[model samples]
Target: MSYNMYLSALLMAATCCSLAISYLCWKRRELPIAISYGLGMLTGAFYTFGYAFEIVSTSLEHIRFWLRIEYMGIPFGTVLWFIMVLQYTGRQALVRKWLVATLMIVPTITFVSHHTNEWHHLFYKSMTLNYSEGFPLVTLVKGPLYKLHVYYSYSFFVVGMVLMIQMFIKEKLRMKKQVALMIIGSWGPYGFTLVYLSGVIYMPIDISPFGFIISGVFYMWGIYQFNMLRLAPLALQKVFASMQDAVIVFDLDNSLTSFNQSANRVIAGINNKWIGQPAVQVFSQYPVLLEKIKQGPFMEGKVQLAGHADEQFYNVHVSFINDKNQRPVGKMLLLSDVTDMVRSEITLLENARQLRELNTFKDKMFSVVAHDIRDPLAVLVNLMELMEEEMQTYGEDQQEIVNEMGQQIHNTFTLVESLLEWFRSQSGGMIFKPVERDLAQTIQINIRLLLVRIENKQIHIISEIPKDTFVYADKEMLDLIVRNLLSNAIKFTNFGGTIRLRADRSDHKVVVSVSDTGDGITSDQASMLLQEDYPVSSTGTAGEKGVGLGLTLCREFVHLNGGEIWFDSTPAQGSTFYFSIPTLSEASSKQSDSLRGGRA
Candidate 1:
């Protein structure tokens, strides 16, 4: 083989290296730095391969064909390298879409000028084979556009070199070696290209393609040895240093490796000097944290630290850090300040305890007062009844005055009884013990108890509930519901007005209703009454007073018994209040099914 053939073989070998590195780097294309560098290497392979073919060509036509092939990689190589430098140095944010397009303009013009050089002669003034060198080689008389392409390519190499140099000067101690290798690798290509362009070396070949072999070797070493592109320490370091959480790194030996600025500020006795110290020694003041770190690779818990002024709380999280091979190399502990959250929870717990105590005291006070006043009010009502019987012997006006006094005493007695019942239900003193009972009999019993009031109002009542209409409910709660609803109906009905009590079965439930023919409530009043909270009560037709506790108690009891209550009121016409309870047979069947399910 001749000297030119040996050079061609060397170029082919370099092309193989560039292609291999391109494939390896492209595998990690998720990283912008890796992908851009990979593309640069791929174009380098194309340029080197075309140069190998160009150097061995015997004819001018074959030489020109190889030259055009070289242009395919030449236009893209430097632009891609410049972009890779920007990303590798953590300046990728400056690579906007418009900026990239603008950079491509000169390369695009260079490619077109070279390919159509036969028409305009702008890329080369003349092209011929120089046989004087023993082997035929393509020799070109440089054109004006050719110089423009040379200058443009040199500009990118210069900029990329400056960026890599700047990064080397500022990089961390451990990363300095990697950056140094990168600088040397990138500078090799520029130096070789300059030597060829300046005619400093008498070489048959361009000599620039060999520079890519240097780049591939150094870049491959940095990738596998220093984990340059895979780890991306330059980009991640910026984010790690700016975190709000205090982060501490530990090696496999449990020695402190590094810590962020936040760790230095928040943790006492933590400083750069503590690096390489055992975790136990560094965390001597925080025994709990040290113990947790020793337990395993992963841990999470809350720790309280005593500050100079007050106590501070932090949520500590520890996780293992794995290398590229997924082997555990170190662990990181992240401490996030949660003092405000902890203090708020503590304050809420204290307030809740105080609220519970206040509720218990209020319930006790209501019980004592209701009991003391209710007994006396009952005795007073009985005495007034005796007085009414004797009042017939007095004058007409004196009898009227006695009757009014008796009505006031009765109203007071009724209010006291309601207050006692309301307080008991609210305090959970009323336990629900449901049993099957005849619902019609329950209604009749409440009516008999309120017979006197019904007679006084001269209201006519119709019972539509059939006999043996049974339902499952707490007996006392059921009686209270029937009595309150019946009394409300009687109070609202006009003199000699009609009142109806009805009951019907609906889907395993018995629905009961008490209706009255009186002036119905407005929409606003209906909304207020339906709410579970304390609602405003109005005076009845007979001047009877209330506080709406009866409706609230009814809703609570209905929900506890697995039932529902509702009402329908037509303005200026009348109102009907309805409530539903489970039927006796249905309730028994459900209880039996529940027992069977539990056994199964």
Candidate 2:
């Protein structure tokens, strides 16, 4: 009715708009609790708006309208205030619904009582004036329902306040204190209303409307200045930490301001010591860390450290925290420790190595098969040519010639059978049955198997294999690896050159070094031999053909047995292929442990 109430009405509109914007922001973030707080604020505005719009003619009607308007906020403010409690305290209210229902019932009865004699005086008295610019005061009277309204109204306030207090006590104080303060501070509106209602401070205009305006303003302060409801800061901190991210917050002058426990542990670091020290001093143990941070953010690469720790990678995201004046306050170093990622990278590299070695092994097998097949085919062709010559020379004894030719054809068939068997195994079409056997015995078996080829090449075989060594590996896979190695050794070595089998147990594993005096590989070629990919096979010295599956199989088998396989060679000097397998004693009964050791 008056200018002051009109002014309060305008303030309510402004409050509503501002809070709506905040609510929108909160909705965008999917924060239902913050949105509820915003709704609480808007409801307070509606309470004020109701007072400003109604020109009450009497005190009873005035009180009734005011209480109804305030009661409308009961569900919104009461529920939302508890929602805030649930957000901060993670505790739900036990009596929230009852409090809301009681609050709403008061106004509903008061609204309905306007038609009855008992209700008549509750809202208004006798018609004191037909019309007036100002509302009249009522000859106040109270009934049971009026008392109920008063009871519920005060009960609503008490319940809301108590819940807010509980939330304050339950939340992390450092981060949530400002929000608690905002809740406490919002009591100013109700306090002023109480003062006005009790006739403690009488003014021409109702001050309760202004009270809502003030409350709304305080809420805005909480939202804008304090970030009271933004859990994202704390949430992000937790998420990053859980993700194994190392965070370091720096102050204005480039000092280490704050860092999580992980950050301290990640560097050759200490707890608490890094808080006030210069960033350079703290990261001095890991000098490259500063360079990574200085690169702005988001560098995914390896960082070499001084200690024996493995090389790690970091994906850094740097942020500059600014002061209230919008000046740069400090830099935030958010480093996601990608040691696992680095390990993955290393695994990929090893896989490439294994794949290349696999290709080389297949090539070796292909060569061996082609050679064995070619030798037989060549002999068979020559035998046929000789038989043709013999058929003409000794036409009378053709039966003897036919018998010798049949034996030659049978030898060729045997060679073809061996080639086919090896091919099937190389193609993953065959599974090996590994039996635990002495390493010395396996070496002896291979030596005997390659005895004919070794003798034909005129190579001197030197056996320095240990007598008691043992490994649990696929017997067939081991045979193939050793046989191919010896065959390649003999094929490439000069006549009368030495081929040595040096087997020893070292590094908790059986180390087998097969060295050869041959036209060996260069360092560069050797690096790529088991390291990179080239689909085509390189020709062997004896012009053999096939995949180098033997070396690949050896590497794979060594891996399966919890060991390693590699090669060290020099051009034209010699070549040595080294493979190691853990002793059978090392293989555990735990299947998962074995999986990790063998397959991880």
Residue-wise lDDT of candidate 1 within 397-512, one digit each (tens)? Answer: 45654666666566566667876665554455333467899988998898899999999989898999999998998777687788888888887888899899999889999999
Estimate the Cα RMSD of every predicted model relative to the unseen true structure: 17.1, 13.9
In candidate 1, the residue pairs with backbone N, CA or C atoms under 3 Å apart (3 or more residues apart, or in different chains) clash, namely: none
TM-score of each prediction: 0.50, 0.45
Model 1 per-residue lDDT at 124: 96
Q: Over the stretch 1-600, how does candidate 2's per-residue lDDT look in tens digits?
A: 555455645755754654664465455343334455566666665666555544342455565565566446533454455445454333322335575475455456655654453435654343232223454432334565556654655565676677667656654544355556566555756666677667877554446556655665666566456644332222233454454567776644455545666775577744543444566787787666676556553544444344523344556577776546665545677666665666665556655755676576567656656754565577668878877898788766667657766765765664565556466555663444446778778778888977887787678988887777777676666776677677767767876789999888775567888899988886656767755332224455554443443454455556645567788777888889887766665553333242233321
lDDT of each: 0.75, 0.59
